[model samples]
Target: MIPIHENLKGKVAVITGGSGVLCSQMAIELARQGANIAILNRDAKKGRDVIERIQTSGGTGISVKADVLDKSSMEKAREEILETFGQVDFLINGAGGNHPDAVTNTETYQDEATGKSFFHLDENGFSKVFATNFTGSFISSQVFGKDLLQAKAPSILNISSMSAYVPMTKVPAYSAAKSSINNFTMWMAVHFAETGLRVNAIAPGFFLTTQNRNLLVNDDGSYTVRSNKIINGTPMKRFGKPEDLLGTMLWLLDASYSGFVTGITVPVDGGFMAYSGV
Candidate 1:
């Protein structure tokens, strides 16, 4: 069972990409804590499904059609959320993913590699990945900043990745974008420090999500080479479950638990960040 934070009761939480594997779990858990959830996704149906689950569990929430990359879209979402919830207490920037075109088929550079290489990476695809991951978060924050600042105890939680710390192979665009998220989190935290708007991030380790499932799993249902390497590197010797992120997320979002904490990215990696591959 997930722990409940009393401070979250009756507050409002806005989660971007709330229909995704990880963020969906966060939306449900926050709802369980009595927070009114606003789930934003480009796919309205998927967002509504999450809301249905929340409602079935006796929680309050709404699904909003939004594109994190578009400021106007986020603005509309924010307006709807405010209309329903009256205020915004938390913002979770959870909308980010990698495109196949932005990735290199080979781990390292190769002069004669037949597959797509770094030199052949599609500029449009790379730009889309970077914009979706980094620019989306930036836009969402801007659209919601005023409402968050007005709250008595507001916070912003960004979803980062383990790649942000150590750039992973084959996905340079994803790595660079996540790294920017870490820096942006710190920058926003300091910018709003005196305003009581805390900004933090959760850098999740290797979790199997739609975005990385292809890279981590094979058609035969066995772990891919990359997945095995990840497990070996993780001190816990396993890929993280979605629930693994809940505790840290709650701790960071709850002012009673982490009021003084800001401008930091907490890694929920099951010791992945600590292991040195000795």
Candidate 2:
């Protein structure tokens, strides 16, 4: 194992949606780096399970069952964090997901007469996706960032998606939400500048996450056509591993290295945004 950094050791980090697939890996690595983790998740069992791994490894962690979309829930989680850890130093806005209704079967044109056009996409589903990704982050930031404004080397890292950079067919709500996250990252950075807090975001590329498992691969483990297309377009020729994001996570959270860096959506993508399918 590599040596952990001195500054990150014993710092408090709050990660929303910490029980999810990709975010769980990030939470573990942050604990391994010697941070006291406060995990906010709707699933209590999963949250405790993630925390137990860190505890087994001699790391400090406390799992809080809370919904990021609910402001009161997040505020209560913040209180719990303060009771246990005294203060929060870093915040990870990791709660977000897409919906089936917010997607289409193809990227091209659509019919409107039968109400199946892009204009006729399920309004409920689209709103749910938007609330989950964008509204959740905003509420979480409000709760967790309260201490960050006063803590030493404070930083806020929001999670965005590859669809944020450009149009990825089928996921209108997801793309819109992530794009808002990118914009909010910049907005929050300036909003917190006077308090010495740094706000940034991680725009991740395609990976086999729990939410996209059905779309990317089959139950038998064969790659789907969409998966093949993504791989071909990526310059790295492979999907990113969850560990691939740890370096950027650490950099953005650690003030000594990325103190002056703020309001930037650092994409941990394998040239997905750069490739034009030429």
Candidate 3:
């Protein structure tokens, strides 16, 4: 809304999965920093809403319907961004999710003798989870990174998860995919270091959102066993808010602040990764 050129105004930022909860917040915050946010998401209406909010706040943004798994779709979106802003300065590869199929029925449910829960972990589901989260982010990096070479300074931020550090049980696919993202962030950072692009990642702890609301709280506003365990394990003793990540996001995106930083996967958890749960 206010004049932005002082800090990060006039920069172009692309956020995949921008329609989702966390990325949507980043889009808004980045816009507030004077960036032209290009929101790319498969969901048309949700992306539109994020754009609308950015516009309402007097920040600039545009919504692009895209599938992170599809290269052509990402290139088209990149073309659209070039048409709108001429260059991309920041890229947030935020498209990812867990599939019900990739998770076992319970954390310690290894009763293959009964074969009850093992049957639930379908191969098709595992494929979907891997495709969407891991493969999609990888493809998006390639597509948008083409422009980074020409820009003065460009940045790539990937979304990882707490699962990457410690497997929480059940969601083996999610853990694997996030771990890949973590590793890829470092690899890409080095691979592109000479090209003026800084690649980094954020591994968030449990954040209550529409995606994981059922797992955290009940309809009556009570915490579940899973949620309690998470709280107890975390030294901070609670789940994270989406806004809790904005500080880290801002620090990483601004070149003036973290110019020398790259290949780092900063954990924005509530000390969850640090605590041994003693």
Residue 214 CA error for candidate 3 (Å)?
1.9
Expressed as tens digits, the lDDT of each residue in 1-278 for candidate 1 is: 87678899999999999999999999999999999999999999999999999999999999999999878888998889988989999999999999988999999998987999998899999999999999999999999999998998899999999999999999999999999999999999999999999999999999999989999999999999999999999999999998999999999999999999999999999899999999
lDDT digits (tens) for residues 1-278 of candidate 2: 54587899889999999988888998999899999999899987899999999999899999998998889988988999999999899989999998888887766665533334586589999999999999999988887776887898899999999889886887889999999999999999999887889999999999899899998997899999899999999999999999889899988988889989999999888998888888
Candidate 3 lDDT score relative to the true structure: 0.86
lDDT of 3 by residue, 1-278 (tens): 22233457788899999988899998998888888999998887899999999999899999999998889988998899899999988889899887666767667756554532756788988888878888998898889878877776789999999998877777887888888899999999999988879999999998987767877798899999888988998898778988888889888878878889999999999888788767
User: Which one wins by lDDT: 1 or 2?
Assistant: 1
TM-score of 3: 0.94
In model 2, the runs with Cα more than 4 Å from the true position are 112-120
Comparing 1 with 2 on TM-score, the higher-scoring candidate is 1
Candidate 1 Cα outliers beyond 4 Å, as residue runs: none
Greater TM-score among 2 and 3 belongs to 2
Q: Score residue 273 of candidate 1 by CA lDDT.
A: 91
Q: Give the distance in Å from residue 150's predicted Cα in candidate 1 to where it truly belongs.
A: 0.7
What are the Cα lDDT values of the candidates?
Answer: 0.95, 0.89, 0.86
What are the clash counts of all predictions, listed in order? 0, 0, 0
* CA error at residue 164 for candidate 1, angstroms: 0.5
**Which candidate number maximizes lDDT?**
1
